[model samples]
Target chain A: METTPENTAHGYIRAGDKEKLRHRLRRIEGQVRGIQRMLDEDAYCIDILTQLGSIVAATEKVGLLILKDHMDHCVRHAVERRDEADEKIEEVVSAVERFLRV
Target chain B: METTPENTAHGYIRAGDKEKLRHRLRRIEGQVRGIQRMLDEDAYCIDILTQLGSIVAATEKVGLLILKDHMDHCVRHAVERRDEADEKIEEVVSAVERFLRV
Candidate 1:
């Protein structure tokens, strides 16, 4: 939302992406609640496990979306400006490692 | 709640653990909603990712708890009864692989 390198480095996602991300998160919350309902209803454990995997995968997709946005906008801007590009790249790499479970 | 080898393989979790698992899941739902609010407030992306990481970690913990319960009750019961022990073990291994992201 801000138009400065400092805000970019400080790390907020693009404003346009915010509502979409929030929407995904709301769905994820519903999924979690669904799993709880499954448990209460005595649903099969394997079915619940499958649901859990999907939830995790969905969450990672949201994360990847955010991470991708950063690369597309913030990091790219930093590189174009030649301003703190190294720090930006390093921060993103660390985030990638965390997401990858490395 | 029901007892018989068929019900076990069909995969309902143990009665006692259901409440606890549901409690954990409720907490996770809250966490996911918390992240949504964070986005709405324009929190830092790294902070959001960190929050995402914790949500994944907590969800996996719930999956693990269910898996462990299956191992302790269903699988062990199968082995002790010599009733489809191989199938139970195979099912659990598959679940473990899914959980471990293999």
Candidate 2:
């Protein structure tokens, strides 16, 4: 049987997912560094702000994607098991609320 | 004086920020579509999961970046105005709490 998100006690992501996540984070880290360099160089305030906005949007997209995955995998698994599907769904709702606040 | 985030009635992002955010979101949207395509192709489950994880992390990073910007710009501006710095700070705290939940 395939390992689901709920299979792990801590809800650990699969190895492949973990690797991809690390790579994306590294790239984002670089982007952040670039923004800092621009600031140091006294780049135009508007330009700096623009880059910051990009970073923010990119980050939000990432979060939403993960949330979707969690719902698809973890939540689905929960339903299959006839376990705490409602709780899992509530957790997702809370997560969505948090995502929007950001 | 430069227009700060708080300057707008809706706390509107600057023009440059808005443009960059739109662009970043477009890229992320493409990435999401790619993931869906992979799913349709019956790509390796692990591979799909990995991509999903990357998307999640990227989204979280974007949220954090935006939160930081809000603190540095909007919150700071609020402090200067001596209007609602405390409220702004509390809002940030709540936002952080939400971010970590993801």
Candidate 3:
């Protein structure tokens, strides 16, 4: 039902996970801002770096969740259709590679 | 010269690099908040996931910068001091493992 991306082939987040993802993102956003504030206040490099580790880990976790949902729903659907199975598999592989590279 | 972190031996960000790190962090903060806002407005999952990738990469990049600075200053200084060389090496190795794990 989403129209903003101009297509129905994307944005396939599961309904239940959407709210959970939103909450996580909001918290991550706050943590990012908090780091900036720490910098502005001249926080320690070690502390800031430590905090940054947490952010990266959190963001990575969120990505994993979305990736799982994609596989569970969208990817599963595509596999069932067989029409876009290769494309979907390739896409998910690429996504996993990106996450791994980080 | 920072007093809050207490007793020094940390917060060793180089003077020249502090502002740069701060600026990068500020932009990253905005990007994070933007993702949250996107969700609040029903942004697509694929789109959000893509955006999340960027955040993870950017945050990782910032962490690398801080790590480099830490090595160049703090770790290097420790290496010069025979007393703390092993400790600093272990500390840096631990940090690297953490970043790599993420």
All candidates: TM-score: 0.83, 0.46, 0.81
Task: Name model 2 segments beyond 4 Å from true.
Answer: A1-102, B1-12
Worst 10 residues of 2 chain A by lDDT: A1-10
Estimate, for each residue in A1-102, the C-alpha lDDT of model 2 and write its tens digit. Answer: 233543434333445664565566556556666654553444433344456555555556555555666766778887999899997777666566544555
lDDT string, candidate 3, B60-81, tens digits: 8898888898789777887887
2 or 3, greater by DockQ: 3
Query: On a 0 to 100 scale, what is the lDDT of residue A90 in model 3?
Result: 86
Candidate 2 global lDDT: 0.56
Error of 1 at A102 (Å): 2.6
Q: Candidate 3, overall lDDT?
A: 0.76
Go through the candidates in order and give each one's C-alpha lDDT: 0.79, 0.56, 0.76
Every candidate's TM-score, chain A alone: 0.83, 0.80, 0.86
Model 1 chain A: ten consecutive residues of lowest lDDT = A1-10
| Model 2: residue A97 alpha-carbon error in angstroms | 26
Task: State the displacement of the C-alpha of residue B22, model 1, in Å, after optimal TM-score superposition.
Answer: 2.7
**A1-102: candidate 3 lDDT, tens digit per residue:** 233553244556766787898888888878988887776676766667778888988998888887787788777988998867997788778777766674
In model 1, residue pairs whose N, Cα or C atoms come closer than 3 Å (at least 3 residues apart or on different chains), thus clashing, are: none
* By DockQ: ranked, best first: 3, 1, 2
- Cα RMSD for candidates in order: 4.3, 11.9, 3.7
DockQ of 1: 0.42
